[model samples]
Target: MAEETKVATGYDTKVEGEIKTDAWTTDGEIVEIIAQDPVTAESEYTEMEYRRLRWKIDLWLLPLMWFCYGTQQADKTSVSVQAVFGISQDTHLVGQQFSWLTTIFYLSYLVSEAPANYLMQKFNMGRFLGICMLFWGVVVLCIGFAKNWATLMALRALQGMFECTISPAFLMITGSWYTSREHTLRSIIWGTSNAGMSVITGLINYAVGQHAERHPGGLAPWKGISFFLGGLTIFLAVLAFCILGTPRDVRWLSDREKRMAVARTMANQTGSDRYKRSEWKWNQVITAFKDPQTYFFFFTTVANSIPNGGVTTFGNLVYESFGFTSLETLLKGTVPQNAVSIIWFLFVGIVTLKKPNLRFTFMVVSLLPAFTGMLALALLPKSGLLWARWGLYLMTVTGNLPGLMIWTMLPSNVAGRTKKSVTATVLFIAYCTGNACGAQVFQAKDAPRYIPGLIACAILFGVEAAMMVLWRAYYLIQNKRRAKKIAELGMSEEESRRQGLLNAEDDMTDFENIHFVYKV
Candidate 1:
């Protein structure tokens, strides 16, 4: 008992509870098992020193994530880009086959989320993710070689399975390094890679399309686009393997620095900078299911992503139906529309940083423009006014905002390794379902207008907005209940603080830890 008390007290002086013996570790290299509370030692380092450390971490980590995320988005959207460039004609795709190509990718992606997250937990995240990237790149490269619709479907399924790890893995890494408050901006920076890559890849594909138009007998422009993107993805994968690492594995920090890094983020209440925990607690998973908020998130993901599926898979094609040439679709349509999305991402990031609790507000705010856009697209006559219809289509990019908040909230709000993992999987399953369904809505028969699809998207966005409001209320009520329990316990502030810190160290889920407050 005396030894247990000593070890427990030794770990964090501010924490006044007994830590489980199993949680104690002699592996000081990965996670320092120091005698004093790290927060005190962290105070000795100057603020500038901490700033410099953050700068270094940002410099090293953000760019790699940004590039990797961008590449993944580029690869996914390449199908849409290639569609405008005659991939359908060349492959003799007809009816729903083209739509199925998009649908199958997300179908496979949905199936793979849980297992991929499990593998990430069991292995070195950087290496595991790197291997997934490398294989997916090869799969993407082989897509260019596909001769028919069946071959394309086969390769797209493979791509979906491999690409499943990117978002969840990136979210885990983001949470591992930064505090909840800091995660928003950094996430936007990397998350906006989707928009960034859209613009960059748009330019590249446009140039390539022009070249293919010049040399029709040589390699098809769509094939060249695939090969080039695949090669770039492989290069980025090698970089991820070489340079990308978890906070625990990062070579830049010393033993003391690693401890301080972990200590600095203690205020997050959400755990960060710890070695991987391989044991999967079934109880935590159960707790996640029992939590009402889990279902709300799942619903929101499905609702928001239904539109996302429509836009991402067919945005370029929709613009083509507006009477623009394929190259004009790439340049005038895809690039500018994505640029608008970039602005939305940056706008939300800035506002959220200045006003932290406004996440739900921004989520609702994001849907309105999309709702209006979809209404216009569905109701307005296509021949009424060309530029006006195009303007309305551009407004649909606002749909992406709610989805971004959903991603941000996963790391910010959820606690416990197993619960977090389970929640992410459920959320992504909804995401996949929504995307898969979204792709099928704009059937080939509905071409030019696709009124049915637009109407569906508009209604879903409103439902999603309502769900977001309800979810926010749920969080607010839950936090109040937790606060009442804390008061009823009659624990002193210091004791409560200590217990909270200990709970965080134990990797307790929000439900398991009574003092854990949900960030609204």
Candidate 2:
């Protein structure tokens, strides 16, 4: 271990724990990277040189991230458009049976989410994800040609398995590129994509209703919608292949821009660059399972997703029950609630900008609408169709709420590559579980009213809220214990400094030596 006189970085290195070169030094040897420049000086760089952003873009990092993810949301959820077509009628799908299609999809999704996130570091995620989009597009296209119920179910399962990486990969990439605070804003922006799904629902319905029923031939409208959406996915996937660049080896930009990008990346992420050097490790999973915080994250993801179950899978179905034609239901049904969600998301994004310390408070606000929406639908006794549509609009958007915190907790708290992989995998498994459970939440037996599922969702909100609060408390407890242990040692600054430099393989041992606190 080397001691060093502190100096800031000159350029971004895209390196995590270890530095490629020292930019500045005063008196001390490089004992531990007390204050890294977060940059890798170029081969020709002088001691005075620093990284610079040669190319400039008008959009800030957060907004760009928001748009990318928003597009992602719209792209993936397009299947909702197929609900009004003759496809379901031909397949003979009922409420419970319909739920299986969704249930099985998330089951596959659960199996894949963690591995996808873990692999993000291993593979060039942009290319891999784009390729996944291509795969899903082909699968969705194939779905349009499916003949029987069994055929549709199989296709849906395949679609979910492929799409699992889309979001987690986005999260992993976002985590790599942004800081905790910036991450939240982008989260909401991308979160607003949930609203975008509804925004397009009307236009999609108009197109499908007018033409799908009787196109050039007797082809079903839903099939047309599926084919069209699948085509769009393919187009985007191709663009991604050409445009998307790997964070570890982003060669699209100039050397200066690359350095700036890396430095900015390192500073924002506080060193996620290490994972780029390696693939997923099983040890990380074991550590993640033991971490109490991971459980809390899981609870929140599942809780929020339970309410989300109604929207992603059965949103159009719920609207159809409101005594409106499919076209009218989609048009009138989706707009108002999406408007509310859009406003709330932007508001929350701004309000919570200053409170990075209280991330859960924003999540709580997002859940509030979902809880109320479900309650209103369950309790109110109108045509039931009338209130149910509005309730669904509100409930559908609730999923975006916890999503912000879910991402915030991962990179902000967990550090090891292995731990990160495990945390992501287990959390996503819980995510799939929540989604799978949600697929089963809506029952045709409850029909028009569906009070049982509504109440189940509402009760779930309470449990979720409590779990989030408890998760925060657990971290506080862990932090306290760690502090007490440090005090008990009563080591001098010099001794403490001495112990900090060992580059041992055990992260648990490293955790204690570095005085790493559990972030809430």
Candidate 3:
């Protein structure tokens, strides 16, 4: 006689008497079941097959993300590029007005973070992000037509509000498809667009600058660059709507393939990309606030981004101040500097891929170059040794590394949907605040060499490095405490790992999942 059993909603069940396992339903209560011929498990993809599937997903997904990220960066950084090409002159921007352009953009970004992420979590990721991209693209194109600083700032503010969704949404999409071990490399591949777009846009602006110079009366080069980038952004937005989606929503993947995709990331111990609950959990939000890691990540974001804001928004100007022509600034200075950033991102990505546990270490390591760069920029005489100063300026690209690492941690380390959403919003709010504040430090009185800004950046880098060490230590302690609790339960290593995977399937938050181990 066959034996019967009952299982809860989450656990596997067996059927007897030729009853198909597919017909079994728990419906949030215990369900009666019996032993029968074992059904073939759905998650039976071989290691090689899994690798191939991952590659296919990467090929399908990453290029679109890369393009989206590149366009977003290009659109945002266009203001800085346009400043060099004569937007400042065209709009009659004077004194602190140029700085206000950056400040207002981030201010709007900060304000939009919570609502934007809420929508990202609540809606289809691809559609929502595409819509944002479309709106921001329109706003960017309108920027080309702005007649005064007030109009320029208004357009920039709107652009910031729309563009705020891209980074957090992409981070979630990346985490959903790839395991923690795979996230760094994938992230770097896309994140390097921060630099990649800079190079491409720099070249475009250089050509446009030359055109404006030659024509002398037609469309300003700044306006021309804006129109071109805006149009490209709209084109990519359409592609994003069609191509980009979460793992579960992609058309190319079969149902079985989607299951395998989620299964492969079980080691991350975070919940599925799909929402398990429609309502927000107040407890998770409270937990996130009380969590020390949250604040460490928050502080790290603020400290690191001050320098990034200073550099990204004003890099071309800084290069121009160093006695280079606007064309040389774009082609010679910004392009090569961003190329160095690409190298840094690629190097860190490769290193982390080979040894996933060393993410925090590498984050700290990447900062050394940035600190050195900022210090050199601060102390070096601005009047002479031009190439040396330029080299130091290039080193500041290391600031990009920490932000990338922080994003990787978000999806890997946080679990609950509400917690993750709230955390992302808080972190980005810190980012916007830092950038806004960073923009102000370089006042009009500072002019060519913003000595105060460079010095502040140097100090912030040192503080950020110290904070990274503290963040790592906090994770280590929490991991140790969790490990001890698991030991106290008398669970074997394999059993604990199994339980962790089970918890992942159940959509448990990091705090509720005792078996979960953070990837440091």
**What are the TM-scores, per candidate, against the unseen true structure?**
0.94, 0.81, 0.92
Tens digits of per-residue lDDT, candidate 1, 136-172, equal 9999899999899989999999999999999998888
The true-versus-predicted C-alpha distance at residue 217 of model 2, in Å, is 5.9
Runs of candidate 3 exceeding 4 Å displacement: 1-43, 274-276
lDDT of candidate 3 vs native?
Answer: 0.81
lDDT tens digits by residue: candidate 2, 1-520 = 2434221111111223443432211133222221333333122344233323312311333344344455455544555556665556777776577667778888888877766776666777778877887888888788778877788778878888888876666666656655556566656676676676557645765776777545647677777667766776777777665455434443354444444444444433234342244645565566567666777777778887786776666666667767767777667766666777788777877766666666776667667776777677677766746655565555646546676567667766665656766677777888789888887888778776667887887888777777777787877777687556555667454443323322211233223234444544
| Number of the top-ranking candidate, with lDDT as the measure | 1
In lDDT terms, how accurate is model 2? 0.61
Instruction: Name model 1 segments beyond 4 Å from true.
Output: 1-33, 38-44, 492-494
Arranged by TM-score, best first? 1, 3, 2
Badly placed stretches (over 4 Å) of model 2 are: 1-79, 212-218, 265-270, 382-399, 480-514, 517-519
User: Taking the tens digit of each residue's C-alpha lDDT, what string does model 3 give over 114-230?
Assistant: 999888867778888999999999999999899999899899999999999999999889888898889999999999988898888778777888888999988888889889999
Worst 10 residues of 2 by lDDT: 6-15
